[model samples]
Target: MTAAPPSATDVLIVGAGIAGASLAAALAPWRRVMLIEAEDVPGYHATGRSAAFWHETYGGARVQPLSMASFDTLACPAPEFSERGFLFPRTALTIGHRSEAGAVDGFTAQFQARGVEVVRMGAADVAAKIPGVRAEWSEAAFEAACSDIDVGALHAAYLRAAKRAGAHVATGTPLQSARRMGDGWDVQVGGQAIRAALIVNAAGAWADRVAAACGVAPVGIQPYRRTVIQLRLGVPVPAQLPLVIHIGGEFYFKGESEGRVWLSPHDETAVDPHDAAPEEIDVAVAIDRLQTVVDWPIAAVERKWAGLRSFAPDRIPVFGADRHESGFIWCAGQGGVGIQTAPAIAALLSAQLGATLPGGAIGAVDPMPFAPSRFA
Candidate 1:
C-alpha cells in the first residue's frame, strides 16, 4: 500500500531565519503554519552572524519606518517572549572629515527630515565621545537612539513564540520540489511531501532559487558578502562606547565586552549564496580604515566571520504576494535591516495574509514600497 500523503498546512514558509520564524509566529494564531529550514538550525546564515544593532537610519529613507515601527517591540518585548530583554543603550556616531563635511550635512538633513532623532556634532564632541578619534574627523551626525541587540535572544524568542502558537518547525529539511496542486501547492522537503495553500519565500540569499524551483518567476534577489572581525585592543574599550561609523561607508566599530572591539570594513562584495568566509584582504582593509579613524592600538585579532546580505533589484525589501502566482509570497531581500525590521515586517506580512495588525503599531506606514508587485 502507498504511504499516506503528508498533511497540508495553511501556510508553508521557506527559510527558518528571523524572517520565516517571525512570520510563522505572526501567522500561527490564525493559520496552520509550517516553517522549514535548509540547515540543521535556524539563523545559520545572516541572522546568526549579524553585528546586532538597531539603528533607525541604517537602511536609507525608504526602510526607516519599518525600523521605527519595530523599536517598541524590541525595547519592551512581551513577557512571554523574553525576560532577559533584547535591546540595550548603544549610541551611534557617523563621522566625516572637514573635506566631507557636505556629506555629513546631507546625511544629517536626510534623516532629520524623516523624523529620525539626529544631531550634528562638532569634532570636539566627536572626540570626547570616541577615544582617539582622528583630527580629520571634524564633523559627525550623532544618533542617540541607537542600541545594541541581543540577536540570539531575539531569534530564539521568535522561534519559541512560533512553536507556542502552534507553528511546526522542521530543520535540516530543505525544499526539494514544489508544484501547483489545484489552488494549493504540493511541496517536497527531504523525504516528506506536504501541501500548503500558500508559500512564503523568506529564503534570504536562496530566495530566487526557491522561487525558480517552484516554477515561479525569479525576482532578481542577489546575495552579497559582508565581513566583520573582533579585535582585542591595547587600550581598554569603555563599556559605554558608542558605535562609530564613517560617513563615507568605509568602516564601523563598537566596543564589546572585555576590551574587545567589533569592526567591519563595510564591504559589500557580490557573491553567490553559500557559507561565507572572511578574506584576508578584507580584514586588512578593516584594520587600515580603523587606524585612519582612531589612534587606538589593536592588540590582536580575536575572531572573524562573514555573512551574506541579500537584496532585491531595488535594495528595498520585497513583500506581498507575487503578481503572477498569488499563492507565492515574497519576503526576501531584507539586506542588513532584516533584524531591526523583523517585527514590523512580520506584522505587515501577517496583515497581507488576512490577519489584523497586532495593536496597530504599524499605523499609517504605507507597505507599497516593499510590495513584490513593484518589481513586476
Candidate 2:
C-alpha cells in the first residue's frame, strides 16, 4: 500500500506569472501557499513576450489605481532587483492624423482631467521626437510620463521574495482538476492530488479555462494577440526619444538600448488562448507604420514574437473571491498592466482575503473596481 498524500495547503495559485508570483510572495509569511505553473519555467507566456515598458497612462481609468499603487515598488526597488535607470527619459507621446484629431484631443483632455502627467505637444515637437514622421500626421498630440520596464528583473524579484518566505513554487505541474473538498479544495496536478483551503485563478491567458475546470463561472475574459519586433539601429540614437504611439493606436516605437529599437502596431485582435506567434501580415503592418516614423534603415532583424494580453469585458483586472464559490479567488484579466501593477495587486487581494501580507499597503488601493463578483 502507499502512504497518505500530502495534506492541504492554505492557498494554491494556478499561474506563476507576475500576479501569482507576487501574491505568493506577499502571503507566504503566515500561510502555506503553492504556486503551480504548467511550463518548465515560469513566465513562459504573456509575461515573457512583453514589450518591456512602464507606461503609466496606457491602461483605462479603472486601471489607474493599480499603476499608481505600484509606484514605490518600481521606483525604489529592492536589491534583489536593481534599478538600471531603465525607464530612461522617454515621454509617452500619442500622435493623430487629421482624421483622428478629435479622438486625440479627447484622449488628452480625459487624462489631463485625471491629473495624469500629460500635456499637448505641437506637430513640430512630434517631428523632433520622430524625425521622419509625417508632419501632416500630427493633427493632435500629447506627452506623458512613461518608462521601459525590465520584465526579467521584476519577475525574478517576486519569485525570490516568495521563495524566501517558504512558499512552494512548482513549475511543470499542470493542474489536472480541482474540486471543493472538506472546508477547502482538492486539486489534482501532474498526477498528484493535493488539498488547499483556497484557490487563486491567476492563469493569465488560460484564466477562463481554469475557471471552467474549477466549477466557477467564466467571466468572458478575452485574449488579444499583439506582436513586437526588435531592430538593431547602427546609427546613434538619442536616449531621450519618447515612446511614439499613434493617437489612433495604429503603431508604436521606442528606444530599447544604445543601438536598438522596438516597434509594434498596437494591434489587439481577439485570439485563441495558446502559444501566440507573429503573423506575417501583422509584421508587415508594423514595419510599414514604423517606416512612417523613422528613416533609420533596419540594419538587421534582431527578433520578433507575439503574446496574448487577456482582458475582461470592461478591460480591467478582476480580483477578490467569487461571490458563489466560497474559497475561489481571482487575480486574472491583468491585460498589459501586469508588471506595472503587480505589487499593488498582490497587496490588494491578499488583504481582501485577510491573508498576512507585506507593507500594509492594501488600504492604499480601493478594492471596489477589481472585485471578482463584478461579473456576477
The C-alpha TM-scores of every prediction are 0.97, 0.92
CA displacement after TM-score superposition, residue 250 of candidate 1 (Å) = 0.9
The TM-score obtained by model 2 is: 0.92
lDDT of 1 by residue, 1-376 (tens): 1233347898999999999998998888888898889898899989999997999999889999999999988999878777766889999999898899999999999999988899999989988998888898889999999999989889999999998998888888888889998999999986788889999999999999999999999999999999999999888778678988888889889888867889999999999899999999999999999998889898999999999999999999998899899999999999999999999999999888977876655756788889888975
Give lDDT tens digits, candidate 2, residues 1-376. Answer: 1222346788999999989998988788768888889888899898888876777677867777678768667767666545443344357887777678788778878877877877776777777776566767765455556777778777887888888888888888877889987788888876798988999999998998998889888888899999999888757666556787777778888877767778898889899899999998998898888776667777877889999999988889998888789699889999889888887899878876667545534456678878877785
Model 1 lowest lDDT segment of ten: 1-10
Displacement of residue 196 (Cα, Å) in model 1 is 0.8
Q: How many pairs in model 1 have backbone atoms within 3 A of each other, for residues 3 or more apart or on separate chains, i.e. clashes?
A: 0
Error of 1 at 99 (Å): 1.2
- Give me candidate 1's TM-score against the actual structure: 0.97
Best by TM-score: 1
